[model samples]
Target: MFQGRRRPWAAVSLFATATCLLAACSNAPPPPVVSEPPPDAPSTTTSAPPEQPMPVEVVVGVDELEGGFNPHALADMSPTSSALADLMLPSVFRPAEDGSLQLDTTLMESAEVVPGTDDFTVRYDIQRQASWSDGAPIAAEDFVYLWEQLRSQPGVAEPAGYRLIEDVASRRGGKTVEVTFERPYPGWRTLFDNLLPAHLLRDAPRGWSTVLDDGYPASGGPFAIRQVDLDRGEIVLERNDRFWGEPARSDRLVLRAVDNARQVEALRSGDSHMALFGADAATMRSLEELGDTVDLINMPRPVTMELLLRPDSRGMSDPGVRGAVTAALDRNRLVEAGTGGRPAGQLPAHAQVLSPSEEAYRPTEPPGAIPPAPDPQRVERLLTEAGYERSAGAWLRDGRPLNLVIAAPFEHESYIAIAETAAEQLRAQGIQATVVTPTGDQLFGDMLAADPRSTGTGGAGSVDMAVAPRPAGGDPASMLASAYGCPGVSPGGETPFPYNAAGFCDRLLQPTIEAGLSGEVPFDKVSDEVESVLWRDAVAVPLYQQAQVLAVRKEVEGVRPGNGFAGPFSTAAQWLGTHADDDGY
Candidate 1:
């Protein structure tokens, strides 16, 4: 539920930026002096103070680094970069274990929606004590600088909500920032999660995009970059002594890059302490044999595999036909066949657009929808009611065979298996259906190729259904809008995003999608409206959430992976090398 407007809140002052004593003091700096007790007055002291604790080193494994660490650019963004960014960059709010947003007091003091203000204004105050690794104060200008750099860049993909930001004004001597949006944006908290140092980026030679690489940056998080050896495929981070909040428990954290196949071996050989693994059923069973030496952790991914129905193609144009087809298929059977005996713990998806673990997850299908067993009789009845009749062992409508070709990409084994199972089931239900495995481009882009007579490559304007993955990240509404609600498929659009498979275009649902992205409406209400439209139209049949598994050594402590964004390292600062009570070295 969305709460109403609240009163303005105040924050306690943490630190003040002090000026150098005397304007001319910088010409010749003062000498360093130790604060030891005077020689004449030190006789009363007992024994010397205890020695400081040594830093703990944590070795983490990943598939590989994606070349850079800039959160704004796509080329530099990867799972490895994101894992490090969650620890190195400042965020106003963070996702809790249950998928709720909580304020990170280290970076931000207080953030609230300003009441009686139009166009959805949010006021944020930064913690005065926060400073970058280079000792520059973290101020409002950093937030403003990030917005200015990302507004028109080609490398920045997710810029819809940011484009709506009219201005970000600094106030109270750089302690606060007021962001004004052109329209209400509900997902504003998702913005400015990673702010770069304005002093470092303000005068870059080539620009911000080219300045960031996989190596290091002037970051302002709990940990700072210590070493980056791409040749050795390892990145090391040490605790930032300048950090103002509770100090990081582990003094040193190392991320080692390894191939997915070698992850388990690396863990077993003691090359890495904690490694990310895609443990299938057999792998998990084998890992269970390791006893108390290791522990396996599984988290649900935000990606969902679904069948995209193209209404522009034949047989699938009618909503009734699509509904009947959806009822005739079993999602669980598809998952079982597609996964090929791998125990990623895939669960059948019911909520249309939201993940099962998300707060807004709810069934969008009507009451008593989708019986336990797929009813072939019900499917036939629905098709008959929609002006289809059985003729010569195939369903026919308007003097043509109700034949459809499902275009499945062989990029992965699961896609082909799902398509084969679907084709077999549809044929049993009296529909003439077949599966055609094509290249990635023909399956997703140019399915309706210009040349209808070409063979062996192009879909030739004959594909009716496609099996693909839909992605959902920090904000699902933005991704859902681009996938479902649109100006139909753009024939001459940009590359990579050539077409919208479903070609679902509903003018009525557009406003709700915008409101959802704007945060003008509660997420539950927004999800309800958007999912209702998707289910009623049978736009796409969602099967299940993608599988994400990780293997951790029992010696690791306090690291947990959430299903969505910010993988296992989201809590890296709390990690320890051994149990709290352990005394053995």
Candidate 2:
């Protein structure tokens, strides 16, 4: 009976367990159900990244990239050289729009004429933060190097300014420059322009001529040379990250040397953003055909186009022959031809040492008052006086024909035009004249720089006369000395190469020129007399101020006409490319 009771209890326990399990199953939560996505549904896994903004670059078209880009050297004074200097070099003073000297606060803290000084002194305090692209401080050593080089180096620009400096005293770890001049220099503002890097160029292997020929050793301006592919006629400048002043608006400035036609085409096709070149009538017309696509302006360069008679050349050695050559050509006609009838061509430069654009320019008449018009009779008389006789419509002396070889730099378009026109005029007057276009170096450095006393007479590859630019400087006295001074002699009695372009030196007048430079005699007092001497000797015939046409595309911004003294390159740092994005898209 007890075993039967236990079996009944087990069955009841099993029934209770089944009831509890059913109650737990009824209270539990249900599993989630997922639906299928549509075939055309957009992605939900990830969103697209933001678009990146493009870098801004401006491409400029020019005539040629002929280098040897030492701005102070006469042989390297080309548009390319000047542009590169303006873009990459530093200056304590820069020309304002009104042609006044303005201190570049970016490079200097202060540059002033020291007060209470009997000796002319200029105190320059460089910005301590001003450092070259290579991380070297821009300091007094640069000034000392430039002063020493300009004072002693031959064929340098405006050496007289540096020659007057007695000493360059540096203080405050070279950040302060104290320049003591032998005498008062009113044109002190003109010194120390385009200051080069002393640490790189002081003992350069190739010297001054080749120091910055291909590319800059370091940059002190907003732009630094990135690449200089002379073979491809291109120079690329990129922003200098180390620049202490305002950064360049554009990332790169590419200068491409191309022909006029190609330049116009490039501008039209959006390949070039601007063009600065010596334009002719045909080139101007082609640029005009672009209509509203470009804004064109005439930029007067601080250079005077002049015909130089090499006094040391065979026939030119005779003053009478030089005068005859001058009498045969018409200055007005040459000006018209050289400028292609541009109204902005400065009035025929009347002074030899100063261009018409200069503030101190004064017109001095030639001695013995000759008419400005072409005088065939005067030409004939002068030639006859020089012991030449007319034989078969040609001037002949000692049974030899008077054949003159006129030279102009092959890279200069306006100079070539002037040379060709002058040659034609000479040929029309029964004078045998031919034009030779050699490189500027061959003409200026090799041929014209030859000392007449040593070279003797004409030889093969000799240039009788040349059509070249008379570089106009800030100091009139310095300009006078550079163009006409005698070869400078060192204290050791050694003469460096001559910088005189005329190859004519008068010992008597040199003292007067020096006096004017040394502030012993006033520049105004000696200018007329000095000019008279140059004119009487027939050293050079001034044509017109050299100028270039600047055509900027409509898309470019922050590019306006610059002062005649400084070309568009002066404000290159402010230029903006068309692709410049405000939103950094």
Candidate 3:
């Protein structure tokens, strides 16, 4: 369950320096590379469809009713609002699963940071006739407002590119809006790239500098919020006739709030034309048995779930104790108990967001690297040699009993199972690792960067051991950036700018980190190499990468899932039945 209720979004974004570079220039920090387009979808700018087809209907699970259609706040990538957003408010650019940047062109001519010396200002040439749903001109200030909002809003966790840029200048003389940078970074493109509604939002938040709540304001995307049927737990999106981009083929999209019990029943009932996100394995299989076929979408990511240790802490200061704890546990048991995919090795499950061009990854692993299984018995032996011994049936060393308390998110049961089993294995090795569950903000809330012992083995903001799904789609650079390359605060004071969360800060990892951030190679290869190194260090155990399956009725032709973007399917762009042919499904 790699769900993102972690709500405050933290993305491994593009950064830049003060030098101004041309729009299409590949001069950013990472190597210049275009992400691979989704194999299943086509740009609407391609030749017109042989014959225009009818629309499609789709459904998905949403946490709450969307207050607004803006993706900046409303997290409703569910089928309904997304469909409507596409028609009401379309993004100027969208990324493929591989991190390639592309232009929507339907509403804008071109977009990029003003060229020359490589800086943060993003300038775009707008299409002459671009207008809002209310017929207001879509101007450069719209982009300016977005940058301003991101900077001033405290609750809005803006991604990387936005961090470096200081502000957006007026569109007075030039057709472009100049986005100023506060520092040097490589991720400028990720910002100012997503266009906003100038007319409606300009006056929004009390004169444009205000933080726009998650409310779906007047969208310039494909659709706007039609209704959130609270009684039925359903959300519906009708088309936005004023859409500037390719006209959405679909007129309406719907979403429901569903849990394990209703996932299969909802799809089997044919109540939804499409489903976005997948249910658990048992639920997925049951849907399949009901003659519901699902198209699997791959969202690779770099971040991962892990169990890290603060060796310098009171009892674990000895390497033997660390080894003892490591050796006592059976990784396979944890994976089988909860994780659905194969072993993650060292890479996080979600590293799929990085571009292959980053240097962190290698084209291929050498022979003997990336092995599927390792000897579990060897693990036990290693710990014994580390000086841990049985003391009254519990692992003890230096009279401390080798105790480690692991705090995991109570909501995620699978992770709990892993911790529980790990405790059992540690007991066998004469170590005590007590596992506890926490709900509310106390769980994984404040522990992440807090002092290890102060958090007393960590709590809230931190996870002693966590079982999380990697990014749905990304590259190794993305993974390294989040897990290994973080500037995170830790039990041992703050690490240097690039902190290795897993405590794997060998100077050796520096080269790989630079390589990944440099964007020097195709991401796929970069991922392979980076994964190898991370695995070797045991930064975090790579759990399995489960498939995100969506149940579609046989009658649903062209009901393909999206590879890029988020969620199971970014419904607004997909077509139902014969309509899929129009979108080249």
Choose the strongest candidate by lDDT.
2
State each model's CA lDDT, in order.
0.69, 0.81, 0.49
lDDT of 1: 0.69
- Candidate 1 per-residue lDDT over residues 1-585, each given as its tens digit: 012254444322222212434434567756679787888874664898996555577788775655567766533444566677788888888886666777888788899989998667999999888898888888888988888765544334345556567889999788799999878776777778777888877887755556776444576887888777777887778778888877788877878877655776767866667876446666667667766777777766555678877665655778888877877787678877766555433556777666555555665777645555578888888899899998877888888877878877664567788998988878878887888886543444346322222343444447777776665465666556546644332124333222345556577887887777766776678778887767777778877766556778877788777534667777888888632222112
**Candidates 2 and 3: which is better by lDDT?**
2
lDDT of 3 by residue, 121-158 (tens): 56677776677667676777777667655443322213
Clashes of each: 5, 0, 105
Instruction: Score candidate 3 by lDDT.
Output: 0.49
Candidate 2 CA-lDDT value: 0.81
Candidate 2 wrongly placed segments (more than 4 Å) = 1-51, 115-118, 289-291, 312-314, 330-347, 360-362, 365-374, 398-405, 413-417, 420-424, 427-438, 456-463, 491-497, 519-522, 580-585
Please give each candidate's TM-score: 0.64, 0.83, 0.62
The residue-by-residue lDDT of candidate 2 on 1-585, one tens digit each, is 001123578789999999888877895665467777898888577768987666788889997898689888777887888898899899989888788889999999999989998888999999999999999999999999999888876557677777778889998999999999878777788899999999999988986655777777899999998877899998878889999999999988889999878999999998899999877778889899999999998777777888888777776888898888888887777788777765336457877888776777877765543348778999999899989999889999999999988888786777788888889888877788989887766666656666655644432226778887778857788788777888776444576645566677888998898888877898888787788877888888877787788999988888876664777898988999866433221
TM-score of 1: 0.64
